[model samples]
Target: MKIYRIANLAILSLVLSIAFATAACAADNTVPGWDPAVLRDASTIKVMTTEPDAGEHWSNLWVVVIDGQPYVRLGDRSYVRIQRNTTKPYVKLKVADQEFDKVKVEEMPDMKDKVAAAMADKYWMDVLIRHESHPMVARLVPEAAPPETPSH
Candidate 1:
């Protein structure tokens, strides 16, 4: 009886552990868009990209809001993680303690000048990035939230 009880308890623990991990993974897979007000005042945001070999990679980046949207600019030879975003456009972002997952990334060359100006306005050092010969620019847009289901 003692052995049976111990075996059952171990199985239960395993099941519960798996359930919690699944829940956490699901939560980390999707995130709602940041509030416009939050983006306006925030100076920096963390970006997480899907790395083919390592799963996910994170980096701190300067952020600028242009027309109520957030954008990040990378120099031509900067860390290549942001470039991987071209193929796997889904990314995770964090501003302060707020986390946004599964946001869509889209390259925006047309907005280069506007984003550069915004960056310069937000960060004095960004003036150099704004002048880079060929900077890579991308926009981060929040994914639509899942619809709520009726509770029974």
Candidate 2:
């Protein structure tokens, strides 16, 4: 009986450790010049994940910023394209006058409810689409710029 109790405790500990590790890996931080307020003010942002071609195209998606993190829930067509994209997680974003060439698309399933709430608050027409199924939520993280070589 004591051995069984010990085994259960060990299992619990392992589960907790894994949970914390995953949370750490998905830590939310904003890039220096990329302001979350810009997204919050803008109604829709253009996102280009796949290379431009005859069939594929850019997606105009709604964005919300919760605690300095930017999140987007792609429309059905965009979602399919993003999933099938050979480039995968890399996306180009244009928010208002700001344009980012290579922002990383981090799918954040855990933030579905939070992102939903923020979206509903920001978008007046959210009531019309609130009943739609919750798809995978995405957090946008800007990639670091490569270091430039010093001039001779």
Candidate 3:
């Protein structure tokens, strides 16, 4: 009887853990667009990307907001992986404590100079790498949820 009770308690805990994780990731989309202000104060965000042959990996990246959109600039290796992933444009992001599971990554070459200026303004450390030519800027836009249909 005691063993059965213990097993039941363990199952309950597993269920609750999954539920909490789902809720955390569901706060993902403030879609239409991310107000740059939402992530403006956040210095860095965690980017989760799937490698070509392996599973997903998370990298910490400095974030900057321009015209109410969030953008991150990655170094060569990360940039190469993104280019390889031509089919899927989505990546996961964690800003502060919030996790976004379906954030689309759009590379904006035309905004290169603007993004650089914004990063330089937000991160004083930008001066160190700004001189080098790491020009891949990926804008993070959350996926909007589908519209709910009324019941028949």
Highest-scoring model, TM-score = 2
Ranking by TM-score, best first?
2, 3, 1
What's the TM-score of each model vs. the native?
A: 0.65, 0.71, 0.68
Q: Where is model 3 more than 4 Å wrong at Cα?
A: 1-35, 85-87, 145-152
Give Cα-based local distance difference scores for all models: 0.74, 0.81, 0.79
Could you report the Cα RMSD, in angstroms, for every candidate shown? 16.7, 8.7, 15.7
For model 2, the stretches where C-alpha displacement exceeds 4 angstroms are: 1-32, 51-56, 149-152
Query: Which pairs clash in model 3?
Result: none
* Candidate number with the higher lDDT (1 or 2): 2
Worst 10 residues of 2 by lDDT: 49-58
lDDT of 2 by residue, 65-140 (tens): 9987789987677787787776678877899988887788899988988988998999988897777765668998
lDDT of 2: 0.81
Please give, for residues 8-72, the per-residue lDDT of candidate 3 as tens digits. 99999999999999998886555644556768889888877787776677778888888767888
Clashes of each: 0, 0, 0
